[model samples]
Target chain A: MNARKRLQFGVAVAALMLAGAAGAAPVKVGMITTLSGGGAGLGIDTRDGFMLALKQAGDAASEVELLVEDDQQKPDIAVQIADKMIQSDQVDLLTGIVWSNLAMAVVPAATAQGKFYLSTNAAPSALAGAGCDPKYFAVSYQNDNMHEAAGAYAKKAGIGKVFIMAPNYPAGQDSLTGFKRFYDGEITNEVYTQVGQTDYAAEIAQIRNSGADAVFFFLPGGMGIAFMKQYAESGVDIPLIGPAFSFSQDILPAAGDAALGVMNGANWSKDLDNPANATFVEGFETEYGRLPSLYAAQGYDTANLLLSAMSKADITDADAFRAALAEADFDSVRGKFSFGPNQHPIQDFYIREVVKEGDVLTNKIVEPVLTDHADAYAADCKM
Target chain B: MLLVAEQALNGLQYGMMLFLMAAGLTLVFGVMGLINLAHGSLYMVGAFACAWIAAATGWFWLGLLASLIAAAAAGALIEILVIRRLYSRDHLDQVLATFALILVFSEGTRWLFGSFPLYLSLPPALTGAVTLPGGLQYPLFRLVIILVGGAVAVGLWLMITRTRLGIRIRAGEADREMIAALGVDISRLYTIVFALGAALAGLAGALVGSIQSVQVGMGEPVLILAFVTVVIGGIGSIKGALIGALLVGMTDTLGKALLPGVLARFMDASSANTIGASLASMLIYILMAVVLILRPQGLFGARA
Candidate 1:
């Protein structure tokens, strides 16, 4: 062999040994979450929760570097951030997205390119079933899981002639269908309003006139705040049921006393009695000076999941990392959290009633509607 | 019949709010010949000002007063510092500049008061529901809004036709150079007009704040609808704005309430709902289009 060729080979070997001896590189997690704009409340909580978990990870904090960027709740902007994170920053893991629509836009693309995306909040149905990707995992429940729990609760409560409403969009459609999946009661009416609509006076009037015994709606964020305010003023005095998103701790203050006595379904609540959850809730409330919502719980859990897997296997080794992640060994804030076959949570969903605790509006866990509840779509997922 | 009555009241209340926004927008567009996209920001600023002050002072009336004052001050400052230069410029420049101001106002508001929305409650005197003629129950605050809009409309008509300032405003709208030649201080007139328009918008925002969550981007959606109302009405006509707002508001409210129920008589429930919802959202736009098709300008648009 030529002398120069032998030297080049030797140098390459030395560099490889040096890299191997240094161990795996630090995991770069790029969070493309909503930080500013209308839904910033949810995104801000998610970011705070995720960062808290990482900060409390002790030695694991050194093993991860988070690059947070605000998507401003725009899908096109989310796509751009995802592409840049994948191509430019070359993040090892992508997490902490807030909305389902934004998730549907970026998740498939990010996972298709072989980047692991552990979702903190969004759990679109397509991702849980037919469109499920091996590299993607939802640390949160399926988008419909909580709504289904609400339906189950309504059925148990014998709510007949139910009037339902949601925004006219994919998530909204999913919410209605999910409610109907478990609910066999006679439906008086089902209405869909415009997405991002802030007024519901007309709809409230119809609900008043429909002769329905109960009302269920899936409007989230600002939409929920508007509906609840108007509903209170209309003096309809009907039973109001909804998914937890509308009555979440993050938005409950804005909804005011209007949300009092609203029954919602969710997998986690601040009052959940568990060691991990107690630690998370206390740590979070201490750090952020506010109660962590379901969004925040999901974000904190996502980070802990990544940290747990990182502790087991080097992130550079894709096969080993996937196996470690699928093991689901992390202590989740939502107790008894485990991955379904589709990498979505097979966890308990409880009925939470919004009640005033010492003049502060918050949710209290009423009953466990579904224990170790796996999504209906999990069976449809071949993976 | 009861449903119709209730929906109509809702439409009127919504239309009144729209008029409050559209009137100022049309007035600025007519007199200054400048498209002020940031009119909505003024609305948001007013809402925030009201919410912030109300929360601090614990009095709804005081908050409302401060919101109007703050909005007028903001409008006057913008006219002096930024808007005056764009007075002679084209509509595109005005649109671009005002659009930029929306971002500035939104971001600045966010910087001052974080991204979370603020809640404003109705005054204790006007908080409950009132029963109408046909056993239809409505919020008193909303009824007040409808009445306030009507009073403002009548007041606007009187001011424009009877008062000297109103004559100057009308004259300024007719011809800027001619008004200036007739010994009118054109710049001061523009500032007064701008501030008046802004104050109306602020009042609308403060009034609506009790019903709606006050946030930074709250103004943009209302602004778009205001622009739609302005187009539907004659661009420079207050009477046109009033009529157009009512028409749009009625179409939207009644369509949303009635369409799904009507469609369900023909199709299955869910599909009927899907189509009804889609159409309900587009109903106002469709009305606008029909108005434009029938009258190349608008229902009350002046022929060039």
Candidate 2:
């Protein structure tokens, strides 16, 4: 009750207030995905991965306020979501996009605003190359990395000639260009169908006539199912191959016996043997009541990577957070990962085959395609 | 040669499927004088019902039957409950109202089916491929689609031209009040016409679903294309629908298939590739615009 004692108590209370403001304020992060359309499964999985990673971190993430939005798979809407998140939410970071076009549309705007954009999916090559910016970091591998791995695997398997197909879109072109990077053999035919096209009989006939040893494609979502069914019915002797997105767990159930024996390359499969991955797979299944796709895995990793950066940055400093993300010093379910110079992930790629494992359908890893394969266009990025 | 034949047949089958969808949209517009943007929702419903029932019953045929019935029933219900309110409204209001229906139906279906797509397989009878002359093999299911589409076209033509209901429908199109004054029970006729349109859409959905994943919103993009088809063919003309559907489908398929090759012959591969892809994608839309310019009303439109 002395004047000196009262002044000391007031100073102590002021110090406590400053410390609480510095360490306890939540790190607000914004995420956007397609939660209401044809691509909803991918979006839902991404959301699950993100939230699961947060759950695993427990109360530690209580200091992180994650704001999520559904883009409805529209590019314009994605841009709007990105804008709203940055301006209204005042988010410190941004992540989550399943489609390449949506990512391409949103990433640049986020980066221009000096916000860190950690892409969970939509690793469009432009973003890896000329479009690359320091503020943008991909939590997933570059869009073409998996396809390039597929091509390399096919060459390793001694495949002489392949027929390739994809939707006639920017991403579809990326799929072919990536495959051709490592595939030195002859391409008997390269076909690009309409984006939402359902019929594949003509393409199947063309492939059969082309006399290719195998067929590689980049038809994701409903397009994949249609092509596989038609390919099966067409009696094309060629084996089918692609990245896991076209025919993974989201698609395999629909593909059924037709997709059996199809080869795919990916960064994560349910059959990956890493302990961190195993825990993730089990936890994801327990939480979501379904197998997690690569999209989900990437989304989950984005959150973990953000956390790693947040811890390194003490949760507030922008420049330090950006540096920590670029360092990518995090234990991921995809195992240890680091970012290459372009802020695109330099990670392992695995060759996997569609197979029925007990009562469940999943991809079983066949072999490692590459260890930390840096994307081809990283030099073009200059970032 | 046989390969070309097969491709052309495939194109024709696809065109016929387009006709079924376009027919429903055109009929609803022509008769009701209302824009129904949720027609595709009915198509989605048909596919989902077919897929769900097929899985539950282990019968593709039964599923097809159920899809048609379900789609038609849904069409009637929607007409009575929602569409009837907008009959006298402006086209823009009708468009907005139906657009809202699209949101409700799409969300409702997603809630029921979850996000994962459902696969509907062909029956064993339609699974095999028969070798055509010149050593080209074609899937039986595609041939069946062509056959079924053709049969529907013929059956539709007969029903419209040869039946008592057909006369009333044509009369209603010319003068709605006149048909009503003649005691033709206009409300019942509207419901029947709407149901008929819905049935065609359902059949198209079921057929296409066997080939594609039956997923929510799958019918939307196609529905837009169907509208383009009717507009190009001449709204209120079944004959125009067939012509427009085939023309649109072939132009779309063939332009996409051949554009890159043609461009590659004259230009550098990369430039040709880029230009060809863009042009190929835009071919049908370009065709639509040209038709609109040339005919104004449409190539087959009946100028009132």
Candidate 3:
């Protein structure tokens, strides 16, 4: 009511408003990933790895506001969550889907709406080829990279005849094709089992009779675990090879000794000698009390990439942010990570061997299979 | 000739596993008239219990025993707490309640043991392959499963045909009200039968878990196959379950083994393999439909 008191209040309000206008608002990110069911292990690692990077950034990442949701590995659920995040939450960017099918469902729509979609995993060929968009970035390798590496490895090892198998799905088809692309050997058999098939007795019988010098399979998650266990017991001495999805750290424990001595192709391993990787492996083991898988590495890189872009350009400017992301200036845990023309990763691939490391079964880098390898679909992308 | 024989054995092994699951499901349906969707959850429970105990104790035998006890105990507890209330309810209500129980068990198990799958290694004695007649090298573990499944089938047969509990179960299946009026503790008998069925499913889970990854949803795929077996075999007949399981298993295995090669003769090898594999997955359902068309009440329904 008094003139002096009113003036003081006015001054305080003015100061507060000035301060608020001076500081930038935090960038909002929506992460939808599998956090339940059988695939939860993959999602949990991704979320944890992403969170660890943000935690390490400390004050720098304070401007990031993350909203996480569980997809339960369902495409419809992922789409619904994406819609909610873009419309209601008004997220500036979206990320963190583990499966390619879910990525196909959410990424195209999200990018069309002018939102940057950074994939932590699941880079299907469809999105990498004619479907490539300016705003969509795959922080992981293209789906075929590991399989291609396996094929190249098989060729190098002089395996004359190979038997290949995968689940009956689009990714499965891509997997076999990727392997065959680089492997110039006689394919003894190309078998497609049921998506979630556990019984492989008949398949094993076929493998035994085929007398292939080696076998390559792309059964991911629990399918891989079951196949490995069954194959080990079958007393079939044929060498086994596959992509890293099956032999990842999350699965190696469940697989036990069955996974030992198996060769798998991967874009990165925990033992990769790089300062960024060293810190990540140490921090992840300390925080989560478990070894980090390639999914985790991808998650860490995705977070760092986001952070690097944020430091360079304002997220509100779509063009500036897109250019910043394309720079990929972050020190990736995978050592050498860069984007291809289609915005998918152009990275080195390694052949890893499963070995016992201090009572824990994990992978060690055996040799580099592909150097600066780009995807087969990149040439098809108009972008 | 050798491959055919081996494929047949694989079919038999697969059928035996299906028999364990279908027997339990059919018995629960026949006696209690309850469509228990949570039967698979009990299977998952058995696997988790076995994997956990086996890993902790380093004894596969103890883990197998624990699987049976744990699954039976879980079944008994659920029957008393949730299932008993639904006995008088319609099939839809039983299905809904049991479906809810599946979520509960899955989430509860995930809470106890994290999302990662547990390992259950085969015993060393049963690790390698054994040469059979004509130099057929078969995995000893699978052979053991066949033998064990055979033993259980015989044991179940004797119990059902010759034992007093079996007679009561048969009488209960015929007329529940009459059995209750005859001074049978119908509630207790239902609990016992449910537990027995649960025990069998759990045993299957534990045995199969050694060969497969023992994870949260591991039971679901097998559960679907078991349901198909139950439908193909009349809903209430043990003998029907056995015969139907074998038929389904054989069809699925043989179809997968021979179809691709057969189709390659007509078409290109790649397309033939793809088409044949897809068709092979559908073979069991086709068999079921054919069976249903011929005999509306199923292969061995007492009503027909």
Compare the candidates by lDDT and give the number of the best one: 3
Say which prediction, candidate 1 or candidate 3, comes out ahead on lDDT. 3
| lDDT tens per residue, model 2, B1-304 | 6656766777787798899899988888888887889889888888988998998999999999999999999999999898888988999999999999999988899889876678888899889688876776888887788788788878878988999988887887788999899889988898999888998898889888888778788889889889989999987888788899998888776665567778877874445756876786588889889999889878888863
| lDDT over C-alpha atoms for residue A37 of model 2 | 49
True contacts preserved, each candidate?
0.61, 0.45, 0.61
Worst lDDT run of 10 residues, candidate 1 chain A, spans A17-26
Q: What is the DockQ of each candidate?
A: 0.57, 0.45, 0.54
When only the first chain is scored, the TM-scores of the models are 0.93, 0.91, 0.93
Chain B structural similarity as TM-score, candidate 2? 0.95
Worst lDDT run of 10 residues, candidate 3 chain B, spans: B265-274
Tens-digit lDDT string for candidate 3 (A1-383): 69999999999999998986675657899999888766778898899999999999998898899999999878999999999999999999999998887888899899999999999988888898999999999999888889999999999999999999887666777788899999999999888776667789998999989989989988777677778788888888788899999798877886778788989999999999999999999999999898999889999999999999999999888899999999999999888888989999989999999999889999999999999999999899996
- Scored against the true structure, residue A103 in model 3 reaches a CA lDDT of 87
Clash pairs detected, candidate 3: none
lDDT by residue for model 1 (A211-278), tens: 99889999877788888888888878888999999898877887778788889999999999999999
TM-scores for the candidates: 0.94, 0.90, 0.93
What value does the lDDT take at residue A204 in candidate 2? 78
By DockQ, the better pick of 1 and 3 is 1
lDDT, candidate 1, at A167 = 79
| TM-score for the A chain of candidate 2 | 0.91
